[model samples]
Target: MKNIVPVKWLLARLYEPDIVIVDCRFQLGNSNSGREAYEESHIPGAVYLDLEKDLSSPIGEHGGRHPLPDIAELAARLSQVGISNESRVVAYDDQGGAMASRLWWLLKYLGHEAVYVLEEGFGAWKKAGLITTADQKVLIPGRFLATVKHNMLAEVDDVRESLGKAGVTLVDSREAPRYRGEAEPIDRVAGHIPGARNFFWAEGRRPDGTWKSADEHRERFAGLEQDDEIIVYCGSGVTATPNVLALEEAGFTRVRLYAGSWSDWISYEGNGVAVGDEKNQ
Candidate 1:
């Protein structure tokens, strides 16, 4: 399955039975904004999925702010939303694929390969002058079986083990300031993991929000070999997914997400956190 689907292609197949369009518009601080936006206007046949409610599990002291939902519960939610293993899933959001990529990665982590993030997101759809609707569509539920792909995820232990490993790379996908410990708007600490490198997730896109070409991505990540293990993380594990997608596009195969990321790391009192511009280098 393609990692991205164009707005024109999605418009052409809007009503296909095996296709499921998901509205993933969300605001980090405003929980009700996404649902309210969907209720006001959404693509025909698109169903809403909230980042906090549908995508994340209940936050605890151990996991990050946006922890991964239980596999069984997530699978059940997907089944309830008419998503089977065979469905062609397309997710979109206003935040330049940040929120949508989470859903994209989650679907893949659950062993479903027919999922994609819509290029340019709902903003592009609106800009294209396409049709939207306020009416809701009811879909018959599907029987989606869940299978966990453990290799695609990295826990706090794996991250600690990879800190100074020769063949591993730990990537911090937040902005340079956040990664450098100069400024931290969220989380308790103001720095990154001791040995991690910075690769801002938004760099994957152009100024207009479309993804860069595959060749460009390959060039951006040319330093790494295909066999090297890459572990990506962000403030709370949400934004790092875009970097994971970018790495895959660059032809890097052995990549994993640190789901707890910096938030969970700092929660451990003994964990080492580096604060300074030098740490980013």
Candidate 2:
């Protein structure tokens, strides 16, 4: 499956044994937050994946706060959650595809093409008048054949090249403050790339946290040239995914994620760092 699926499509597959639903609601500053919403209600039969507990590895100074987990370990984790190569996985969260896209990308990384994200996520599912369930089930383990998708990731070297390449658009998906060097909540240095534009990933979603329509997304990103290659980044790589996912939905053909992002960029020894509107300077 592609990166996104309509809620109606996923609803039809809800009861099929070949499908697995995952709830990925997360509140960035509040560690104990998401589960309450999940416990309060979720898509029927969905298993919850916690950002702090399940989706990421522990933080270290040298590592981004949300380092992508080891494939072997992540494979094992998926297996424990009853995900198999044959299973079609659908991940969703309250926010656009922020946390959900992480799992969507992870599934692709694991070579599972049957995986997809709920286009507008759980928020839209509920608004469609679907019934919610408080019944979260424990999954039975199943083996998965893990295969990593290497090209989906943008390395530090890729960003370096993008600085000099006129055809590439390095997009910073962090909030305007962070992108403008007005704030530095997660990383030590407070700055953006030498020539990166601000996309403000959250703009793709509504106040309720569901993703907007593809047309709306296309309009928001209308400032960019269609032929330019896009590389998206946030605090780490986690938050930027919704922007990448949004671009995908908007009909942009070539978009990639900077897996290490600013966390990896500024911290590297001898790497150049810049603050404030670096988009043209």
Candidate 3:
């Protein structure tokens, strides 16, 4: 519930015992890349969470490249990693906040509130001249419970129900070209949900790949109704978490993530995924 903390604040909390820092730096081209990075060096006293091993049920065609694993499995994983209900978690990745926010939203989706994404990520940490260590950590086993909140998710039915309705805003977090159907890297189809606005999550990143200031970010979501409920999605459920965090940071509290995202949405046989310059639509 607190504001997104800086790397320095996280370093200050490094030895708190109740703090859990997960390094999420994964290369999309090679899944094992993150683990290699962690093996080389990571935040002093930080642990590596393999995107495929530690997270997700498994990669599949219908489930996108990475699908949300069952709640019980995730709960058990967190518990196995020594996270408890009282533990405060900070998740981060090198590619802006895309991968980091996945863990952040997963904690929230599984109903854990004490989670936050490292504002800039591992790059920012190294840039700050922070210490790194290759020492492996051993977790003291503890029980962690999650109260799954399904309402925070929006399915195709909910999107259909809200279309043409007043005070409901849809945002696609995919790149502009991808949202326009001009490019398709991971998914079979391009474009986005009809009546959705574009806010490419990568745009929030600076040239150095750190997140922008709250003021500048707030301006990005400007002109939208603060009272309107915001539903955000991307290739899958991952990238959209940054948008959720961004809007929440901007003081818009009525935000939800379409966990299925565009990948899941387009998989629907009859769903409408529009193409073209949908910026103003």
Candidate 4:
């Protein structure tokens, strides 16, 4: 399954019965803002999925700020929104591609291989003078059974086990400053996991908010080999999915996501933290 699709590609398949367009726009602090934006104007026939409500479970002591949602519950929600196992999901958001990628990752984790993120976000879609709507479209629910893929996830213990390992490479998807311990905005602690390399997730996108090509994505991770096992994470595991998607786009097959991420790492008392630059490739 391709990780991304252009706005026009979605535009052409806009009315397809098997296609389900998702609006994933979200703000970290302002939780209601995403759905508010969707209610105001959205791509026609699109259903809204909130990052906090739909994509994540309640934040626990050890599972990071945005823990992965319950598979059964999420599948039910998808069913309610008319997303079945065969639905060709195209998720879009205004927050770069983070929120949309979160959905893409979740759907893939559930063994729904037909998921994709919009290459250009909602902002770009409106800019192109494409169709938009405020009216909510109703449809009958579809059966969405989730077959969870355990291998695609990396728990904090898995991350700890991979530290300094020869074949496995841990990639911190946060920005350089946060990885360097210069700032601690969201999480309780700064810095990153020990022995993890920095690969800022935003680097996957261009200045205009469009995703880079596969060759460009390959160039971004030129330091990494295609066969190496890559584990990616960010603040609370939300932004990291884009890097995971990019890794797949670049043809890196052995990639997994540390879903708890940095926030969950710091939650444990004995977890080691590292500062300053490590190998950045």
lDDT of 3 at 44: 72
Best by TM-score: 4
Q: Which ten residues in a row have the lowest lDDT in candidate 4?
A: 1-10
- Candidate 2: lDDT of 54? 81
Q: What's the lDDT for residue 72 in model 3?
A: 87
Summarize candidate 4's per-residue lDDT along 1-281 as a digit string, tens digits: 37888888988999998999999999999999999999999999999999989999998878999999998899999999999988999999988899999999999999999999988789878998998999999877999999999999999889989988889988999999999999988887889888888989999999987888899999999889788899999999999999999999999999999999999999999999999998843
- Lowest summed lDDT across 10 adjacent residues in model 2 is found at 58-67
Lowest lDDT 10-mer window, candidate 1?
272-281
Candidate 4 structure lDDT:
0.91
Off by over 4 Å in 3: 1-3
Where model 2 places Cα greater than 4 Å from the true spot, the runs are 206-210, 213-216, 223-227, 278-281
- Model 4 stretches astray by more than 4 angstroms: none
lDDT of each: 0.90, 0.83, 0.81, 0.91
lDDT of 2 by residue, 5-89 (tens): 8888988888999899999999988977889999999999998888867877777664466877777888988888888989999
Clashes of each: 0, 0, 0, 0
Which sections of candidate 1 miss by over 4 Å? 278-281
RMSD to native for every prediction? 1.3, 2.6, 1.9, 1.2
Candidate 3 lDDT by residue in tens digits, 1-281:
35367888898898998998888888777988999888888887677777677776676656555677878888888888778889898888887877878888788877789898887888888989988888878767668898987877787688888777899999989888888889989888877888898998888766766667777788988777889988998887878888888887778878888877888877778878788875565
